[model samples]
Target: MIERKKYMSLLEKWRDKKVIKVVTGVRRCGKSSLLRMFREKLSDNGVEERQILEFNFEDLSNEPFLDYHVLYSHIRKNLCGDRMNYIFFDEIQMVENFQKVVDSLFLLDNVDLYVTGSNAYLLSGEIATLLTGRYVEIKLFPFSFAEYIEALPDGTPHDTAYRHFSEKGGFPYTVQIANDDEMLREYLTGLYNTIVLKDVVARRKITDVMMLESIVRFLADNIGNLSVIKRISDAMTSQGRKVSVHTVENYISALSDSYIFYPVYRYDAKGKQLLKTGQKYYLVDTGLRNIINGTKGGDLGHILENIVFLELARRGGEIYVGKVDNAEIDFIVIKGEAREYYQISLSVRDENTMQRELAPLQAIQDYYPKYLLTLDNDPVVLHNGIKQMYVIDWLLQN
Candidate 1:
């Protein structure tokens, strides 16, 4: 397994703290592996075997513990009261009323807990009421470009690795079958079906699986385009599906809750507030996009933007599509009191393209650091106040 350094740093930082550590992401994004890896790290770092316990609710043998009371009892029996007991629970959402178990364990004076969930519901709505503000969340993503390159075989060309990362995306399992296109497709298709079945359809209790899949395809095909519920409903109805706006909105919400799609709203830089419309969705993994939209030539610029969007999300910030006057900036990232603007393009070698990409950044009046990232392999340049650098170089940089 590739070591997720950034996430590991987060886990290590929160280790042995009083608060519960919740690791969340889409399935196969390595949440379970992260917890297990950290468990090993604890043991290696002098934590006794008796002080640590790990359970994966997905395992059939652990079926009996699906009852919150039984699981709580089982964990209590393993506790070493004399020392801090380290506990790891994988896919805690699989247990019904699992938060009860979490609540009971958290009351103990000598316990440090870590839990992983595949669904966002683990931290939202009524489900998270029991542990609200008592736990810290670590949002994990698929392997990043830097981590992807580490997983590649020795001597793989940098450009070739970048192409593979762009095409297949950062799903950790994709690395094992990177050479086999046929097998990779089969894996992604099955994985997509599982996500819809377990996370979306079953969780939401929806009967129209086909309609939900269609919505997913639409979102995948238009990753960086505006996602209007009414427009989507009308488009489906035009094709004779006859769906309501309410239904479209519900389906999109389910997809977002399942961590399959992320919606980014537009930010008015001039007004310094989020706009009510013109939001866009980006997929969790591009490989899943290939399953919906066939593996063919795609909009390279949008793909780059999607990759950059996810990277920014991983960097810890409130991200928004920037709306400055009439021009649109690719991203407006605000971390604490600092704000950074980004414009992603496939290539800006053409003078017209360069000017167009620079326009949005130049329109911004403040000096909080504006960047123009492109695929053009040239020395970092500055267009007035905006810094132009290669996107690949930016992704690889520490």
Candidate 2:
């Protein structure tokens, strides 16, 4: 494991707190691995092995707990009398009525609960209501470029790693096994199908699996584009597939719930208003996008933008697609009272491209750190206020 210091720090913050620690992310984005790492940390901290009750619903041995009663009883029976029990439930959402079990265990003073799930639905409607303000959700994403570089061979150049990262993506398992592209693609495809079929379609009782897949693929292929439900509906109709605008929106919601694609709302920072019309969708992993669309030739800029979006999200910022006047900023990340603007481009070499990339940040008229991240080696010195840096270098820095 290439130690994720950021998430580890979050774990330290909520280590023994009363609130439940919920880890959520896309399927195979290393949520389970993060739980395992934390469990090891607990052991290293002298937490007794017996006091930890680890249950993975994905494993066949735990299938009996699919029923809420059995799950509750099993947990209740496993509780230690004197010591505080640390319960680590991996993919807890797989069990029906899991909120009841979580709520019940949370009521006990002797238990510190940590749960992992692949989708946002793990904290959806009822679950959110049940654990309202009583839980802290720590989102996990695939490897950032820094983590990606750390996983690569020692002799690999920064450019090589960046290219591979752009092409293969930052999915942890995929990054680890670099030899077999075929196997990696297959695994990503299967994971995507499982998330769509089991988590979204099956769990939500969605009737149109084919339409859902089509909409998902369209979104994946068109990352960073302003997407409107009506446009999506019309496009699908033109392709000889019938789907209502509302149905398309519902499918998009399902995808978001499953953590497959994250839609970024446009925030007009200057105007101080949130726009409701158009939004951008970013894939959890570019590798999965490649799998869905078959490694295409163009759209490298959008892929890079998606990577940066997820990275900012992993850093625990509330991200928005920033719109200032007619110019657009790729992301505006706000944490507490601090905010930063970012623009992502594959290259700012061309004069027009440089102006286009810097225009949004220049228009902001604020002292906040504004950056333009690119793959170019040449240092750009345009726009007195905006900072220009290589994306990989930026990722390596704090």
TM-score of 1: 0.98
Poorest stretch of ten by lDDT in candidate 2: 377-386
lDDT of 1 by residue, 178-267 (tens): 899999989989988899999999999999999998899899989889888888998899999999999999999999989999999999
Q: Rate the local accuracy (lDDT) of all candidates.
A: 0.89, 0.87
Candidate RMSDs in order:
1.0, 1.5
User: Where does candidate 2 stray beyond 4 Å?
Assistant: 380-382
Per-residue alpha-carbon lDDT of candidate 2 for residues 1-398, written as tens digits (9 for 90 to 100): 87888888798899879999998888888888888888899899998988999999999999998898998898889889899899989999888889989999999999999999987878988779989989999888888888888898888898888888878888888876667888888888788889889889987789988888899889988999999889999999999998898889888998898888899999998986789899999998888888888877788889888888877887777889999988899999988888999999999889999889888888888788899999888665546878898887877776
> Among all windows of ten consecutive residues in candidate 1, which has the lowest summed lDDT?
124-133
Residue 9 in model 2: lDDT: 79
